[model samples]
Target: MPAVIVNIQGPYTERDRKLYAFLVHAVWDELGVKRIHELPVARINKVFEEHHSDTSQGWIWESAKRLAMTSVEWAQVEGEDRLHGIAHLFSYAATHEAARADGVLKFEFPAGLIPVLKEPRRFARLRIHFLIALSGKYAVTLYEILESVANLRNPVLEIELTKLRQWLKVPEDKLDRYVDLKRFVLEPGIRQINMNPEGAGFSAQMEALKSGKAVERIRFVIQKLDTRVALEKQIKPRLEPPVPPPVEPMSAFGILLSTRTYEKAKQAAPDFDIYGLEAEWRDWIKGKPRPNDPDAAFVGFCRKRQRRMEVG
Candidate 1:
């Protein structure tokens, strides 16, 4: 449900996104506790290592100024209590002599937005590292939307082309054609999302649906590419399913292994490459019939490898 209407009056650039992400990460833990937060500029600079130097107080202040200039029409009518007024994205973005010395940035959101900010449940479950790793507005925005539902069983997201364009903040004067939008924004965004160094935790793609000849909707399909197979597939290609046995140990390749598995795996292998050994074990189990308790089997594989190494 749409709750608020925001009319922006300034450009939302990559730097703006960086500062926004920094603010989100900085204030995440203190949502309901504090209205104002002081962000350490050096720490934020570290997150965006390529951008600002240790003394880049000037750079952060510029971004903060942009945010202050951007205003939102924060109007809410709850029963008889109506809040109707124009407000900036942040209530106050101020700096002092102490801010320069301490290398900090002080800011606060409009009080009316507190209810929205406090409800983390509606926010996407994303890491600040993953978010900042993405460059460009489209790629970052696309990732946030896709990742929100990526954990759902074989998730797919569909939105009107107009709405998608608006969500991506595609300028009205540019990329008017569907082909152009797909070529410039959708494809490149998907590539960057898939290739991000931090890893998006899932893979994604966009599909265009048409209404009689004109494209009208965009469909985004995503899969939860869990770490196990993401690691194992590079080492070995999974083939046809093995005939049903009890199940081999550590055969749960696509699923995340429990800490219990990791502990035992470490104990069995000791100094062995646990992950690589896991891949080798997975490869060895091919076409073999095995026990149902496959989780413990991985430890057994390591122990056997240890014994062989000991003897030789």
Candidate 2:
């Protein structure tokens, strides 16, 4: 009888964590190994491929028939999601007792194994929830992974590589920043948080980053033909007409008087109607109200100015 070992790697995503746990749980039952043995995933992958030679190293697993197993599929226990973390599981055809009798592998785990391997899915979920808690950011890609594998029938021999690829892809913006921070935050000897942004934690941190301003203010607002385009993804504003400035009676009177003066001057002498007249008058008044007799005053002033020009 022969025995196999599984190795789990760190820096694993939520999907990987869940898959690893399910694999170990399912295989532990199949091989009659009651306990999990903690080991390095790189080593397990290397050794497993060396013997089986059927499954690809660190990649797709053909059907269980290929591995001489009864069934092969992603296994879900009560609550779990796929691609939450990365782990490798090995299924030995022989029982641990049988293997131990053969003097190859032990039946028990490297003491305190349940503490490490009991809940891979929980670990993965915690990682994501924590990241969102601290950074006030989320990788849409990771969320999609949790959604992908929450419900599955089998776990030991069947895992989907396609789903794994999709899960591992870190979204563009978060990917760059996440890789840089993983070195400091996730490294050993660093005091770090477990679940991020519990309750309003992420929102509060995000609000703080805004320096007491709305996120909408930072986003671009573009008015285009047909429809307005907001480059930043946010909820669309409510449909309402923009409020126009208040119209004043004085301003209206000044405009009417100016029009009348222009008309009279054009009839008297046909040429360019005074350019900048409205602007100049408006500026002099400083947005003040025009006199009630503005029209009469304009006529009298124009006549006086005309006589003076003729005399000169």
Candidate 3:
């Protein structure tokens, strides 16, 4: 639930938000300090499984590439000094063959942005699990801002409409009118956050400040949920290994291809006829020495076959 200061753009897809959240959590220990971190693909895949339920190795790899390419703008103003720049989430490298083989992702934080990411007295301790369930970017943004001030002695936070829109990264043309903004963005986001059991353990409502019949600023009233009720609802079941469902007996060919290898092959050669490719792979490997790791060998065969097909 630690917070990291980030300047992100609007219209973030669900996967992108999840990836961003993961990155924030991954670098929590090193936040505020210039340091590189090693994040294993397996750990990231575990989070993907919890949030997305699909953790194919190829999909994970592709997602990591996408996350690495995402750019964000950072700006800080300290009295007479002003700093601003754009950078990707992190710089990536495999470092070693063993690291690549094991699917380790190395991330180097930008030195200039370390100060913002470091420990700060005022920051949002966002509950990642709740954020995962929220589909709208507005909901996530509002939840973070409200959660940051939820524990303050006075639970009322006020901000101008323009600043709120900026912080939420709302597009300029979208929700231009106060009524439209309240009806579309504010109402739905507040409703979603309040409905989520793990969302900051608070319910939020907004009061509009009117200037001569025109809404000027908005105030958020955040009320914390009862401690006992919050604790009871937050209890989560311990994670355990998934039990394989019973299946019919496999054919000879099916038995030869382990589940892991078959999945890898499917991902690697989605366009190729899997049965035909399997037959070809089987025939090609017939006279060869048995591979130490059959799954890896099968994946390699699928990749090579895919390349050949692309060339042909």
Candidate 4:
């Protein structure tokens, strides 16, 4: 729960990531005392619900298999110096058939790998609730890396750009340019992390280390938020009256009209009244099948209508 093993990979899918994180939490309390942990399939599913509000048997089984097969490699400064192996996620998995039937899941971790999670020299402590709602892998990765160092006196984590990319699991070809990485990856990841309702609890800014105009190291200046201020903001909003939610449309045409598709239609045919066009479209689609992509279909109809009016 507190430490993250660095230079780890795989658990690529969202479900897989959540499953691995849940396993870490499950074993956290019993880290040193026990090598094996058993969790009821119901409880594991509950963990998913606590975060995501839903789960299925197929997803659980797939995630379990993925975790069991995943490998983690790391370098040791002393003694062996380097280590690598498959199925390093756990030493044993005995939940094959039972897991499918909603039974218990039993996991046994490798002895040496236990301490990597159990007793890390440096690690990030984060609220599991905050992590649950995060949709992007990059957001989760950056949050963990930054949160790990948030408690330090300096609260600044500086790493080489290459190493940062590796930690982020960025492919070599993607975001190859520094500007592109900052624009697409770094900014969006930080934005998503900070946008959480409970507050991301930290702010990050990237500083470039330049050697004769060539950027090298990236310094992440992380600052922890003051809890008092965050709490005040949360409380102040409750005093106001709750606003009513937007009305949802029932029919396909209504759905399209209520969406940004309506705005696009207006733009494509500025002189054409959207209300009248909606009526025309509703009539045009009468006795016909509904479109799978109503928004696109609406736009196409509007363009055709605009062209016909021009010809007339």
Candidate 5:
């Protein structure tokens, strides 16, 4: 079965709230390790696989696993007013299994297909290349190659200007800062220029050269190149998925209960705590009198009569 990826949002029901809570607890147990199946997320994983299939052992499976492992990252998109949203990464095998067991699948991903995942070890230096190819950007070819070397933490990998032109099929003069900006998509954290150490303080030089002062064209070009290169390094590493925020208490119930018309309760029980109110509501749920209230006798009688349909 081929894998599929999808996303979901939430103002979840009682059952969903409980299930999401349980899944979160499970995910915390499985951090920083492979074999994502062993995590608490497995329950939701099972739900996903039921809609997908696990029968394949080819590149599709690898892709499916990558999609699944990163599936939990949907939490990054959750908003303050939104209770929850889900993203699904499942295979045909898993989805079929789920349909056989549960009868129907409710959620569908916005993207209909999952990206093919590359073998981690086999992609030691070619990871960025694979991303560029997957994204179908021919212009990104040499840029990705350089980025791959940069990501290896190899500080000495240098491409000659002529070699870079031959490799990228672009003019030497046209080779610009976009190449460096591409690095942020892959590495996201590195900052500094490797090719020109003396060019570190070039931004001010560019500003000073911008007055159309025919004083020095060659110096201006160098300064412009340095400024653009700095901008690229400054922007690349931010391409990774954002860090998920710390989990906070849900405010939906608070907002909903606050807006409900409990005018009498507000006046009669001015300091009525919600938990206390719920406890009271549960106890009085079975047509029982609310304890210690003079009005409890009448409320209980009315409730009992309603149950018997005697008044109607």
Candidate 6:
């Protein structure tokens, strides 16, 4: 199986991750296996329309730019020997060809990655449709990581805490509290994976094992909806839009605010304009690194603001 690692921040947004999967599916499933390196111009809407109808022509070019700009670690694991290299997601990509007004993208597989795709000796049969269907970066990543081992008879995959963070690309400085880890990463990701019928359609669970009071490892237990169907379903490959995550309330600056944060803000600063304070809080947090629980952070800020008003 091939291993891919990308920095989770910056252009590696949820949309970009799905686009990456879309590109892979286009190459492996649509483009002829013989033409393993070059991808013919394919309509971005054909792949992305169901998910975002308002997807603009500019986005295709911009995404192509990001792909050309960002580098990813590519590795293929064989029994004892390992192959590793770094390259831009695309060796070359052209999405802004004036000759083609249609919103389409064409790209070449990075050279280091071409050999692995040509004839994969050991590979997981990852469906491009299901991968894009899964929501969130963590869910998409977790599904891919878990599917690699799904072939094992009733597998219970367990990893130490540190390794899981590395795989999920959770910044080491962020999501430090185990409760925060569970709330922000583990549960949400698992819910996204288990929520879709068009997806893997298998139930997954995470159990955090503690050493004294500290979380030491996470154990993922995957249960097949139908052992046969879960492992071997050859639905005609088609990308289907997933049920998107619920829209969270937005701050005045268009930043998303969790419901808990909103409610606490209302309580913390009844006489104050909550969204305005949220905007102020967000700005103040810009240069400062923040903890995992953003709701708590915002609440604390509001309390300080209230105190300042009383003292002043």
RMSD of 1: 13.3
Steric overlap count per candidate: 6, 24, 1, 1, 26, 0
Model 4, span 114-161: residue lDDT tens: 666544422224444456567677777777677777667688988888
Off by over 4 Å in 4: 1-6, 9-11, 50-54, 75-87, 96-98, 121-124, 197-199, 228-312
Candidate number that wins on TM-score, 2 or 6: 6
**Predictions in order: lDDT:** 0.64, 0.29, 0.61, 0.62, 0.29, 0.59
What tens-digit string does per-residue lDDT give for candidate 3 at 170-231? 78888899999988789988989777533346788899998899888999998876642333
Model 6 lDDT tens row, 51-74: 443365566566667767766665
User: Which regions of candidate 1 deviate over 4 angstroms?
Assistant: 1-9, 50-55, 71-87, 97-101, 118-124, 151-154, 196-198, 227-312
Per-model TM-score on C-alpha atoms: 0.62, 0.19, 0.58, 0.62, 0.17, 0.61
Best by lDDT: 1
Q: Say which prediction, candidate 5 or candidate 6, comes out ahead on lDDT.
A: 6
lDDT of 4 at 44: 69
**Which pairs of residues collide in candidate 4?**
124-148
Worst 10 residues of 5 by lDDT: 250-259
**What are the runs in model 3 whose C-alpha is more than 4 Å off?**
1-12, 32-34, 53-88, 91-102, 119-124, 197-199, 226-312
Residue-level lDDT of model 2, residues 48-104, one tens digit each, is: 343332223333122211222321223332344322222223333223332221222
lDDT of 5 by residue, 119-225 (tens): 11112222111121122222233223333333232223343333333433343355354444335321231122223222222211111122354221111111223
TM-score top scorer = 1
Question: Cα deviation in Å at residue 304, candidate 2?
Answer: 99
Query: Which stretches of candidate 5 lie above 4 Å from their native place?
Result: 1-138, 151-153, 171-312
lDDT of 3 at 280: 51
